[model samples]
Target: MKNSLKLLLSSALLLTLAACQGQDVATLNLEGGDNIVGGSKVSSWSDLSKHVLSILTGPGERIQICTAVLIRDNIALTAAHCVYQKNKIRIAYGVDLYEQGNEIPVDKVVIHELYGGPGSGRNDLALIRIAGNLPRKYKPVALPSVADTPYQGQELITVGYGRTGWMKGAENDGRLRQVAVNVDSTDMNKIWIGRSNGKGICQGDSGGPTFLKKNGEYYPIGIASYILMMSDDPAKKCLEGGVLMNVVSYLPWIHQNLPSLN
Candidate 1:
């Protein structure tokens, strides 16, 4: 069963990547190990911790395949690639997979106009508006100042419900997890993270939140974009590093679409 699931996921990723060929941006299908590489499972949920959510695509099977972050009572921030498809997108809030927490139907989705398709990873952002307000436990994460810049070697925290291992067929436990990743480098619109330590983002983590701690408060700085493969292993895990779409770079677009949240 696990092997079948992995194969299906790989095929889906390949199809998405193939569709993006010829674009200036780099592209790679989604593949990951058991969970967030080198990260630990979160045993409990924090007050704002529920801000991180699992995104389920498709209609019948409804797989909890991607992660997203709540930025307002009704608005969520996620990778454009995650919602590029025509399938129904649902948001699950909570730490456990079996708990059947609040599941909200997405009322509308707004992908960045310039998003260069799924694998391009350029302008990779989207805003999802739920049909109604979120519960009290779920709170929006604060956005970073557009002027802020990530520096190399700076410590950052990532939270998501993604796969756990680098080996093939490693399963996602469906539990929310957190990991500390150091910023390896940065560009005008992206932040690269990870190193030999193995701690980094993985498949099913796309659209999750990358946070910057300031004055002891966590602020959303980037959205999980894609993995930067450094190996030719068939497993296709994030052995090299990962890329994050700098949230600051899209502040104007975000504010323009969700002006009420700003």
Candidate 2:
């Protein structure tokens, strides 16, 4: 069951901890097709915390959960595959989803125009705007500028709500987790972070933010898109590099869609 569940979606399977409406964790399908992602659990909403939130997208029984970062008071950014279904989607605010937090209503979800539809992960980026103001703690994180480029050997910090162990369902606990991965390479479309000392991403981790620190503050440069699988074994599947949709490359499109962001 574990082997079958982990390889359900695309040939490459994009990534998302997508599950049924009531299930704790679903099989791997789209981006961040999570399994046991290695990272430290975040217990407090301080420093670079809280800026990240979970997205719950329901289109039929399939409920896709992905991580998104608040870029504006009411606007958040994530990978296109996360909210592509665009059904009854909502954003959950808090370090832990099952905890005492509110599932905020989303007013809008705009996927990138260039995004290839289902199974085509090209230009996988999107924006989500909620209906009201969020708590002050969930402040918006800064977006990278068009001119900005990730320096060589940049240490990127990634955050996700994905599973923490081989059998530990990422969304089963709904707690946020993080890891710092070094840049293996980057291109106009994506940033690639190789598996670090055996640590990488898994389900429930899609659309999460990859931050580049500058002047002591973290700036979002990319969002989770897919993981390069090296093995068919579920435990070793996510042991390769992780790919992120470069947020910096989509600045123009984002500005055009969300004019207020400009």
Best by TM-score: 1
Q: For model 1, name the residue pairs that clash.
A: 33-165, 34-163, 34-164, 34-165, 35-163, 35-164, 35-165, 36-163
What TM-score, to 2 decimals, does candidate 2 have?
0.82
Candidate 1: 10-residue stretch with minimal lDDT: 25-34
In the range 26-68, model 1's lDDT, one tens digit per residue, is 3353422113777777665564366787776765433436788
What is the C-alpha local distance difference test score of each model? 0.71, 0.68
Residue-level lDDT of model 2, residues 111-199, one tens digit each, is: 88888864455888889888777788778878888666765577888888756543433233566777888888888888888776766
Per-candidate Cα RMSD to the true structure, in Å, reads 4.5, 6.7
Candidate 2 residues lying further than 4 Å off, grouped into runs, are: 1-36, 59-61, 166-171, 260-262
Model 1 TM: 0.84
Model 1 C-alpha RMSD vs. true structure (Å) is 4.5
Residue 252 lDDT (model 2): 83
